[model samples]
Target: MADSLATWMPPLASLDDALLRYLDQTGVAVLVKDLTSGRFTAASPCAPRVLVASQDIVGQTDAELFDAVQAVALRAADQQAVALGTAYAGEHRIERHGERREYVVWRHPVPASGEQGPRILSCWQDVTEQRKRDVLVQATLAQLEEQQKANAELRREMQDNQVRDSVSGLYHRAHFEEQLRREADLSSREQREFAIVSVSIDGMDQIRETYGADSCERVVEALGRLLKANTRAMDSPCRLGGDRFTVLLSGVGLATAHSRMEHLRKACSQHIVAFNGQQIPFTVSMGVASFPHTAGSVEELMRSADRAMAASRAKGGNHLTLASIQFVPAT
Candidate 1:
């Protein structure tokens, strides 16, 4: 189709003008580049929409019209399309008037005719708004998935009466302990490792004293939503009373657990709870420990994670700490 568009030519100059006029009426941005001279030979009326704002581009090279970097990139793409002898499609980003714009372009090589050397027939369309809409759709889908998970968790709680806290909607400590035991047993049988994280809300007491009691609940709810959104179905998020929480990551190593918890810690630090037109800021400190790697028993695992969490809190919070692995000397 691109080859046909490039090679289609009428025998009369009037028909050529008519063809360009028709393309202009259709609002298609089109330009013809003389490959030998590396200069644009012709452009449609709508070509300015994709390229520079100048109406005249007939005798201008890419370097004269676009910025240095973009000019080189455009020239390289043109050369590649010509060498391949086929149509090329690509997306390009261009900054104009302090705003970034994205464009999708197709370039096809036209055969030499008469005195005219081989030329590149180029077509482009602005896709900035389309790309924005795609991003918006993806974000919306993610939010919907999070909401569905929350609803499912709620349904499970209603069926089994397992929820511990009303505000955060997280599992009870007993339920979390049961899950942890089951995970340990499964990992032991499968010869794999799982991770556990101890979480503590930093400055919760100060926040409660400053912003009143309800402010602390607001932060807890926000943290619960984040935990649910970030965790998988197999993982468990539990509130261990007060401002403390724990997460059980099934079949995860210490490094992976630390990375994931670090992201969560950052999210918590950035999150602000709004109440009665006032903003309450909060942060969390996390400790990541793995099963059989950091501790051999549940009692030792909780203590190791707790010690790491204390260390993170000592560093002024909003940090994630990993428990050190114990090495035994060979006899």
Candidate 2:
């Protein structure tokens, strides 16, 4: 609640023309209260916007101008500012036309003059819209973070599903070759040994002719499962199309690779696939070779392993073979 500008202006200070225009035009509500009489002594032209319109606010107490609850709060803040002899700030919520609004109020105690006694200067600023915008920004940032995480998970799943052979669930030949090159480089650089094994289903042609293509697929799938089960997580097992498969064993030597492959060969020979109301038994032949033992390079190692596998199939099905060590003269 406020009075005419001329009546309240004289006590506070000498107001210049520019200061008078600013007080009239600004949205901030400025008011002064007399501490002794507990009544409003001065007000800006815009002060009426802070409360219900009244004809005159001069010499009016908060109880006469505002509701009971607001009156008590206003009185408390004024007393606190005067007692502290400094500026104090607080927030208040008011409802008008069924719409709730928020404001930040600041109060400062003005020293008593010759006859005016002490006064409290107060300014009120509306902050409802700024608070709403802050909430909206926080919610938007949270939603965006969730969406980014979801997209990253989706991309990982897609990569896992797309880079493997559908039937064997093992990496494709292209991926296998990439791994081969990487392993070769690592072994050469670190002076460490690793093994490569080439595998093929023995008597595959005869089995396909005797039991149809579905039977062949059943046998291949069974061999794939056995290979996966027998290999370590660090090993790379790949399906190189048709009945061919290969494994790369990291940090393994020739003897260890041969022992592991022999175990896998036995597992393949023992596994039976059930199909079309009949059980089909199958066998796989594998050849084990090591880097710097059987061959010096990736290409040479693969060729040597393939030759050994062919030799095993020549002997009989369900057998494992090891590539011969290359003899080199002392340099």
Strongest candidate by TM-score: 2
Listed in order, each prediction's TM-score against the native is 0.53, 0.60
Residue pairs clashing in model 2 are: none
lDDT against the true structure, each candidate: 0.85, 0.83
lDDT, residue 104, candidate 2? 89
User: Model 1, range 1-331, lDDT digits (tens) per residue?
Assistant: 1223334332123335566657667665788888999988776667876665664787889888778998889999998998999999988898766788888889998778797889998887788888999999999999999999999998986865645568788888889999999998998899899999999999998999999998888989999999988899999999998899999998899988988888888888888889989998888999988998999988899999999999999999988899989776799
Give the poorly placed runs of model 2, Cα more than 4 Å off. Answer: 1-26, 34-41, 48-99, 144-170, 197-237, 242-288, 304-331
